[model samples]
Target: MTTDPQILVQAICTLACYSYLIKENFAYRIAEYTLVALYTSYQITRLFHSFIKPYWQNYAIGEKQYYFILMGALGLLLYTRYAPPQYRWLARYPIALSVGWGLGGAIARSPRPVFTQLMDVMRPLNTANNVLFFVFFMAVMSYFFFTTGKESKFIQGSGRLGRYIMMIGFGTAFGNTVQGRISLFLNRLSFLLTDWLGISI
Candidate 1:
């Protein structure tokens, strides 16, 4: 048993939300709204501390750089969402800047994965795992080979093997996801039964 009032309150909120599973009423609605409000408040506080405050302190007040001022002005322009129509064109500039910057970053990072996969496949086949990996990799990759096509027996067989491997991989992934959900449900039940109700198994 624990003596923390915060944990007790949290457990109560959890039970309140879970009450909907039995039947929906005021308690569940209150609990749902309370969670949304708390989350919004927490996010606002986090962003203020992590980003807004730091940016203001370093760029807005201390350094007073032209870049920061431009950036800050552009960011503020996003609030033009509520402004009249003539000034709405100002909003597009910031949207374009953010989208262009994000796309440039994604383009810069695109080659790393391809290069890594290439390097992995080119590793020496000194061990059993390496040999098997190379074989399976080639088998899977046969699905993408366009020149010879699947007219050849070898290509068809390899593609079939690759399909089976992919199916097995997908099934395993689905099973793991179900297991994870069950684990979460059990954990919540444990919190309700043991922590709140003080019932030991």
Candidate 2:
């Protein structure tokens, strides 16, 4: 077994986390809460070093850009949600500002990506794959023909093909997600065996 203190601690934490797979117990709860607390502290430290310290040193005080202080105050107002019920309304301004800013940014940024996707889908049908994709795309799009009558046989056929293509796409995506999770699990297992136990696999 590895005697390094850091490695030992990590091994213990890993075992504590894995214990949850068997049944929820004190060790699992401790591991869960410890991870959360550590992550929260780490994020706060990073925020201070990355944003708060730099903002204060460069913009707020150094450059005499005192308007930055208002931005800081606006961010702080988000915490007022935890205040007394009457004072909680103070959080609404920041919340609304954040939502509006995010919405506007998203609207501004969406067009380029949508246009790019449309361009990609309009690729030349020179290759077999491109031709197949074009057909699939049209069939899938036809599935959304809400105004088309059920008596339209062509539309019905295309819509049914679209549904099957969608099902296959969904299944493939789900399989990839499961494979990724399993990969993570295998990596952790390898770490336990090779790093903690000092086993040559």
Candidate 3:
């Protein structure tokens, strides 16, 4: 019953998307394509305003940091992907540069996460939960000792416990993911019922 244009359009799009659950049709396709097109255009506009414009004005032109122009040109080379067959190879230089830079950055930053987890695991065993965590951590670490001989019963028992702990951790993660998705579904359903239909619920 809402008269607001934005809310009405949102409700219509939501229904169009949910219609696919019943059966795919032109309405669902229209909604899906519209969402993709809108999202793409929004991202392009945001990139231009947030990054390209500022970089050009501040670095390339104003501050005489002309190297930014070369960077921009390199980025432009990525579009050579759509060029004719013979000319498409020009895109690989930019692609290769990007890959190398990304890999180097990732490698440099990767140790931070490992160190963070290690620090967390090295917490004081002052509480029951902390003690439990330390024991579970050791068990899991023992399970990965591929070089160690499995003749000892202690290692076998620890590894078996580690496997069950891992299963529980995985199940918890999966349940959290499902809960997040259901939360989104509930929000959309609430919008349809309360905002669109003007219901009190």
Candidate 4:
């Protein structure tokens, strides 16, 4: 069976992206830039259609004129970065507002997942897997605490335990990395053999 035109185009783009593994050349760079440009254009279109146009046309023009004014002020403030050195400090107004709003939003949403979950994990009395999890947690935490003199027997013992725990983590991570690389290699090999050379997998 023949592939669709859209599938053929996608396959060509994928091959171009995979070409980077062989060497950095025009094909890879072109594909990379093309993908980025397409994504950026799509995002700009989405922002205008979904946010700016709808909000301005429906809400801001009617009962929310104040929002339009605020948006204009914020937009002008963002442009202050292009001003002369003497006026460049004006950019801080928009920057500060953006950061403050972002921080508030993040903090409002963070506590339940971050603090509550941490507290729940630390509360060994209420935990179902308390023994195993607490031992693992303490072993990992001990790896970073060096206040106890390294020369002391107790400190040396804890340090050895921590070292083993860390080694195990590192070993697992390394194994995962190798597996991922092998998978990537296999994918490229499949593309080269099956697509370009027309060999059946």
lDDT of 3 by residue, 16-119 (tens): 99999999999999998998999999999999999999989998999999889898898888898999988888899889999999999999999999999999
Better of 1 and 2 by lDDT: 2
C-alpha RMSD between model 1 and the true structure: 3.0
> Which lDDT tens digits does candidate 4 get at residues 1-201?
235565467667877887888999898999999989999999999999998888887778866677786866786877878888888888888888889999999889977787776676675555557866667667677767777646577666666787887898899999999999999879867765676556798
What are the per-residue Cα lDDT tens digits for candidate 1 across 126-195? 9999988888888888867767755788998888888887787899999999999999989988987887
The local distance difference test score of model 3 is: 0.93
Query: In terms of lDDT, which candidate is strongest?
Result: 2
Instruction: Give candidate 3's error at residue 72 in angstroms.
Output: 1.9
Q: What TM-score do all the candidates reach, one by one?
A: 0.79, 0.91, 0.87, 0.74
Task: Supply the TM-score for candidate 1.
Answer: 0.79
**Best-first order by lDDT:** 2, 3, 1, 4
Stretches of candidate 4 exceeding 4 Å from the true structure: 1-3, 122-129, 149-156, 170-201
Which pairs, if any, clash in model 1?
A: none
Higher-ranked by lDDT: 3 or 4: 3
Compare candidates 2 and 4 on TM-score and give the better one: 2
* Candidate lDDT (C-alpha), each: 0.86, 0.94, 0.93, 0.78
Evaluate model 4: give its TM-score: 0.74
lDDT of 2 at 143: 94
Query: Stretches of candidate 2 above 4 Å error?
Result: 149-151
After superposition on all C-alphas, the RMSD of every candidate to the true structure, in Å, is: 3.0, 1.7, 2.2, 3.9
Candidate 3 vs. true structure, TM-score: 0.87
